[model samples]
Target: MKKRLITLCSTFIFCVGVQAQEFTPKQLEQVKQVRENALNSDLSWQLLESITTEVGPRLPGTENDKKAVAWAVEQFEALGFDKVWTEPATFPHWRRYHESARIITPSEQPIHLTALGNSVSTPEQGITGEVVLFETLDELIAAPQDSLKNKIAFINYRMNRHVDGNGYGPAVRARNNGAVEAAKKGAIAYMMRSVSTTEHRFAHTGGSHYQPGVNKVPATAISNPDADQLERLISSGHSVSVNINVQSEDLGEGTSYNVIGEVTGSEFPNQYVLIGGHLDSWDLGTGALDDGAGVALTMAAAKHIKAVAQPKRSIRVVLFAAEELGLWGAKAYFERHAKSLGNIVAAAESDFGAGLIYGFESNVTANALPIVRAIAKQLAPLNIEYIRANAAHGGPDLIPLRERLNAPIFALHQDGTDYFDYHHTANDTLDKVDPIKLKQNTAAYAVFAMMAANSKNKITNK
Candidate 1:
C-alpha cells in the first residue's frame, strides 16, 4: 500500500509539472519546427564566416569598425527583415600598434604581451624598471607607495575555468583595475597575466580603467607562459627587471552606429521581442567568439523564426556597436528606445559565445515567470532548462535597458567553460566555434524569441 501511494504521488507531481508548462497546441508545434529547422540549418555558420573573414576585428571607431557596422546593416537587410536601421554611438577612438616586452634582469628573454585598450603610449625609447610582483590585485592595492615607486608592477593572477564563467569576475579585475591601482602607487607601468584559462603564448588584450584626475600609465598583458617565466624568476629569490614599449594611438572622437533589423508581428505589431549580440570585438584575431558568435546566433534565430511563421509581436534584432569600448552602443540604444519600453515584450542576448546553451534565466516581471517557464519547456529539445535567475542582464549590451529602464531580460546561459581560453586573444578565431553547438544555440534562441513574440503575456512590471 505504501509503494502504491508513493508511485501515485510521483505520477501526480509529474503530470502537474507538464500541465504547468502548457502551451497552445499551435505554439508547441511552432517550437518544434523552429528547433528542427535551426538544427538543420547552416545559415548561422555562413553568416559568421562572412564577418570574421571579411571585416575581421572591429576595434572601436576604426575604419574596420565602420566596415563592420555597414556589413551588419547589409546582412540584416539581406535577411529580409521588415525594417532595418542604424543608431549613432559616438565615442573616443583607441588603436593598438607595435608593442614589445623583454625581461632584462636575471636573464634576457622576450615576453609576449599586448597593450590594453585605451592605454597611453609609452616613451619613445620605452620604459624599464625593476619588477614588483603581486600574487593578486588586492595585494597590489595593499603595497605602500614607496615600494612601487619607479618600478613596474607585475600582477600574476590566474583564472579558473567554469561552464558558467564564474572565474572571469575575479581574474578580470586585475585587467580592469590593475593599471589604476598601480598608478596610485607611482608605478611607471603595469603588466599582468592574461585573464584567460589557456596557456597559449598569445597575450590577451582588454580595457583598463583610470580614475579621473589620476595619472595615466601604459598597461599591458603578458601571456600565461610569460607570466609563469616571470614568476619562476621571482621565486629564485632575485630581483627582476623588464623593459616594455607599448604604442597605442588615441585617434580622438569618432562615430559608430548600432545596427537594427525587425520582423514585424502579425497581431500586436507594436509589441516587441528583441534579441542581439554586440557587433564590436577586441582588436585581436578575428573577433569570432567574443561577440561574432553572439551576432550570428541571434541573427540565425530570427531568420529561422521568420522562415517558419510570424509571431504576434515584432522581433527586433540589434547588432550593437562599440561594446568593447564600454557598451556605448547599448547606452544609446536605451536612450533612443526608452519610450518604447512598455511595448517591448522581452529582450535577450547571445554574447557568451558559440557554446551550447544549457539553461534559460530571466529577469521579467513576477507574472511573466510562467511565460518563461513555458518557453523553457519548449526549449527542452535543445536541453535548455529554466534556472532561477531573475537578475539576468541579457548581456553587456543590454545593461542600460535592463537596469535604468527596468526592462525585462532573458539570457540563454551558454557553456562558456573554455570561452576565456581564446577570449580577447589572437586565438579568438573562426575555428574555435563548433557549428553543431552554434546551431543548437540558434534553436534555443529561436524558440524563446518566437514564443515571446507570440505570447499574450505582459512583460512590464517590477
Candidate 2:
C-alpha cells in the first residue's frame, strides 16, 4: 500500500514540472515584436516584383529555372544569411510548342484551351474525330465501348467555390487520371473542363499523372466558357466533330537544382527551423501568384529575422524545384540529408496563395500542444484562430519529407476563397495578389517561425 502511494506521488510531480515549463508572459511579448517588424518591412512586395519581372516564368529543367536558382542564391547572400547553397536535382523537361482546338462542324468556332503539363502531342496533322461528351467520369466508364471507340472523349467537371477551397481534390481527378481511363475504353484523345471557379475563356493547365503500363493519350483542358458551348452544341442533337493539335514534347532528362540558405543560430546552430516554397512554375503565365507570392513571403520572413540578428535557433530556407511536375527537389533533399532529419526541429511550407492566415495547426506530440497554443496567443491579435487538429497535409511539395523523414509539419491555414479562380491558369498573375494581404501573411509566418525556433520544446512524433 505504501509503494502504490509513492508511485502516484511521483507521477503527480512530473505533471507539475511540465506545467511549469510553459511560456511566460515576457516571451509572448517578444513574439509580438517580431510580428510588428514583419508587417512594416517592404521586402515581400519588392522581392515579388523582382522575381516576376526579371525571372518571368521558371519552368522546371529549363534555363529560366536555372536563372531563378542563381537569383535566389544571390538574394539570400545579399540579405546577410550565414550560409547559402544549392542541392542537385533532376526533373523532367516538358516543352509546350503550340496548342489549338477548334469545332469543325455545326458553326465552326475556336475554343480557348491549354495542354496539360507533361501531356504528349497529337499526330503532326492532329486528330480529328467525332466528340463524345460525358457529364462525369462515372458516365464515361459506363458508356458502351463502341460509342467512344476511336473518338475524342470530353469530361466536364465543375469546381465550386468554398472558403476552404475543398473542391480541388475531386475536381482535379479529371486532370490527373482522365487520359488513362479514357484510353482504357479505346478513346483516341481526351479533353476536360479546366478545374477552376471562374467562367473566363482562359484555360487552366496543371500536371497529370499517367499510370505505368497504361496506354497514354493526348489530353488537354478547355475553358469553362468553351465547355459550356460544347455542351450546348451536343444538346442540340447535332453530331459535333473537333480538331485538337497539341505540340507538347518531352526533351530527354535535364538538370535542375534546389536553392537553400540559412541564418545560423546563436546557441543551437545545428538545430533547424526549416521553411520553404517551390521555385518552379508552369510555362503558360508569368507564374506570379501560384508560387511567386510564396517565394517572396519566405524570403521576407528570413530577411526580417536576419535584420534583428538575435535569433535563438537557425532558420533554414529552401527553394524547391519541379514541384509542379513532381516533388523531385524535396525527395532529393530528404535522401541526401537522411542523417540530419532528426536534427530538423520543425518544417513549415508556404505554398498556398498569399492570403491572410486564418489559423495554425501542427502534427506533433500531444505534449507539444501547449507550445503551439502559446504561439497562437501571439497571433490572436491579428484575428488568427487556433485549431487542435494535427494531421498535416504539408502541401504537395513536402510529400517526401512527410512520408519518409516523419518530420513534424506546421500549416498556416490561409483564406483560399479566391485561390481556385486563377489557379493553374494564365490569369494567375501579379495583379491577383493584394499587397496589404501579403504583408499580413508575412507577419503571421514570421511570428510562428520565430517562436517555434526559439522554444526549447521539441515536437516529436505523437
Reference-based lDDT, each prediction: 0.86, 0.82
Candidate no. 2 TM-score: 0.93
Assess every candidate by TM-score.
Answer: 0.94, 0.93
Worst 10 residues of 2 by lDDT: 11-20
- RMSD after Cα superposition, model 2: 4.1
**Which candidate number would show the highest lDDT if scored against the true structure?**
1
> What global local distance difference test value does model 2 have?
0.82
Per-residue CA lDDT of model 1 for 1-462, tens digit only, reads: 655554454433223333234456777787799889999999999999999999998998778888998898899889998899999998768888889999998889999999998899999789999998999999999998767889999999999999989999899899899999999999999999999899789999988877897789899999999999999989989799999999888898778999998999988999898899999999888999989998988898998999888877899999988888888888888888777777877889888889989988888777676676778767876888778767776788878886767777788899999998999988999999999999999888899898888765556545
lDDT by residue (tens digit), candidate 2, 246-339: 9988997777888998988888888888887989888877777779888888888877767755567788888888888878888888888888
Off by over 4 Å in 1: 1-23
Q: Candidate 2 — number of clashing residue pairs?
A: 0
C-alpha lDDT (0 to 100) for residue 173 of candidate 1:
95
